[model samples]
Target: MIGTPRIQSLPQGIEVGIKALAARCREGEKRIAAALRELEAFGYLQRVRDRLPSGRVITRTIFCNQPTALLRPRRPAPARPQASAPNPASEHTGPSEQPAPEAPAPLPVPPPPPPLPQAPPSVPLPPSLPLVPPPTAPKLPPGPIPRPDELTPELDRAATALLSDLHRRAPQFTLTETDVRQLVPGVAAWLERAAHPDAIRHALTDDPPVPLKRPALLLKHRLTELLPPAPPDTQELAALTHRPRITVTPFQTCEDCDRAFRSPTPGHCRDCREHRAEDLRTAA
Candidate 1:
């Protein structure tokens, strides 16, 4: 009989289904189908349906550490017979029962071997090698320095994306013309390495102004640095604005948990709960 303790030690559903599965395992079609159903119900169990030597699909249970009581003991194999040589006297004597021949004489022993010579002592070498001059390193010419006009497009796009992510984070910080001009020098220098120089210039132009992204990014970075991570629900944000009916600004999401705080405490999103749980764990 299969041991209850061995099966009970396994994951829950599999343990319960063991008896039902044994008979089905012998039946190829039923075995795989039953395993599949079990797997679907309990995702933790990793079972595979494989084709047997009989060309039929069967459930192949893997990684089971069944106790001795749960499994049948394998039968021991029979020992092999040893081969014997024929008797020499019997082979030679047919009609005349002849005796065995005498054994040959032993060889003579030689005189004692000579002793081996001992090895000579090792001599130390004198350390007086002449010093050779070291090889000179080649001098490399300095590369030409980049000018402001050398800003590339790829650099601009990278800066823009970074700024966009930052702006999304901090809504309180407002960007201004002065801010753009202040960031222009460093951004122009960075643009030299960017692949798309024109894109960066377009972003900075006064029309819509490209440099706004930099200041916006800086504001976001500062805001996150100043504020604590957000609470789970938008209720906190709604209370801050004193507008329960109003929709929350996308940037107002909690730094800790990205839950929109427009509504009351209980209305927080599912992710907010996990975020809060993690926060509690860390705090503890």
Candidate 2:
């Protein structure tokens, strides 16, 4: 080593080491400050408060540790006296002084009086209701017992007259018998035959359709057809003309006699007709 220069005042080894340590610490502080500034520039830290070079906080800080001075409280201004008119008993003399007054003694209060009781109400009497009268029964008029008329027949008159000489006799009863017979058996037979095609065509061709009845009625009906049609002025005559009439054009073979009748009337030939006439005369 080069000759150590004699120093006017020499630092001890501990002192030099302390100086070196302090320089390192100062460099560390500079690095920490630079990193903090970079974070702040990158928006990592929000500058809430400004700091002094000595590291003491000037304003209140949110995240970092730094000493802040306690703010001294401001003294309040002295109160001025009001301009209101003062009472002689309440006038003040000094800042610390107060007005004095005569003391009062407490007074005793008496207890309240008790409530009065009320009397009970009396029961009321009810008036009696009027009684309703019963309804009267209706009166009936007497009827007359007159004698019977001579023309009007009495139910028990014959028995009374006949039983004049007898006592406790019952009257005889009479009942009339009614006779009912079916003379025309083929009333709706033609109506059923009207459904046939030949009958339908014939009805279509004819001025009016024929009626439904027996051969005797048909013979009479054919004779009626020979007469002229009625005039329109007389509705009764027109109705008679318009009235349906049937006619039987009998075939050669007769159903009743089994003999062929050459003429139109089949069952009652000229001989049969004479026989029928004589039978009718005998019956008359």
Candidate 3:
């Protein structure tokens, strides 16, 4: 019999299959199956098979709290007695009675079927088919691979000039050939974007937005940010010609103070020009 706690713990409503019940109870499948059979025997659980209209048979489980009425045992039917052979001595009193007919001999049993053929133990199995290999990608046309020493004279000249300028401005931050090699790619990128060498120099020398711990890392970041916009495509340029052109102000740099400023003038900064005028007036 199932314990009260266990019976109470049994899931209600929808049926949880045998595997689920076994998992929940932490018991083996055979043990859970036997337990369920015992419960059914005690009339605690009833299993009913239902045949659907689709010809599919499904077993339905019903739980009962109260014990059901025990079924009566079925009695075996009495076997009929077989006829015995007639006695030869009893035939003398009745001479007129005909002799009993001889019984027919039993038929012989058929021979057993032939044994099936089995494979030899020493024979090896046939080799399996080889797997198909994956398709190879199409070969692409090879282009010239860029090397550090193979840079064009113009690019090489620009890289050297930038390195020399950096050395002249900040001698304490000396760069090695390896450092120059690493920095060349960034300089090349800036050049490719149509940035002037002078502008690259200015950006490198200017006070960084953040303090630099490593010159190489800081220079790389500055070059990336200062990369100029690419030239507009021919199609875009043609499209823009039809639209009204908007005038844009050009930026200027002071020749005397070397400070960048927004102005229509070409040479000295406003402060430098003002100072020069003041000095001239004082002299007069």
Please give the clash total of every predicted structure, in order.
25, 0, 0
Cα lDDT tens digits for candidate 3, 101-204 = 54433222223333568867886779885575446745555332223324677887787678756867765446777777777867876676667877887787
Ranking by lDDT: 3, 1, 2
Better of 1 and 3 by lDDT: 3
Across residues 1-284, which tens digit of lDDT does each residue of candidate 2 receive? 10112111334322222233335344454454554455445433223333443546543211111111112122333343444565778656756444453233221211223344677787787966546534664444422211222212332343233223111221111111110011011211222222332342232223322443232333223223332232345678788889988976656765557666776644656677788899999999
Model 1 Cα lDDT, one tens digit per residue, 1-284: 32324334657435234445565345454554565455434432333454443557756343223222213332333333444566776665358554454333222222233445778987988987546644665545533322345446755555445434433444433456555434443454544434243444334332433445554454333323322222445687777788557565442455455655644443456577687889999999
The TM-scores, one per candidate, come to 0.14, 0.12, 0.30
Q: Model 2: which residue pairs collide?
A: none
> Which of 2 and 3 is ahead in lDDT?
3
TM-score of 3: 0.30
**Model 1 whole-model lDDT (C-alpha atoms):** 0.44
Ranking by TM-score: 3, 1, 2
RMSD to truth, every model: 31.0, 44.6, 24.6
What TM-score does candidate 1 get on C-alpha atoms? 0.14
lDDT of prediction 2: 0.35
What's the lDDT for all of these models? 0.44, 0.35, 0.64
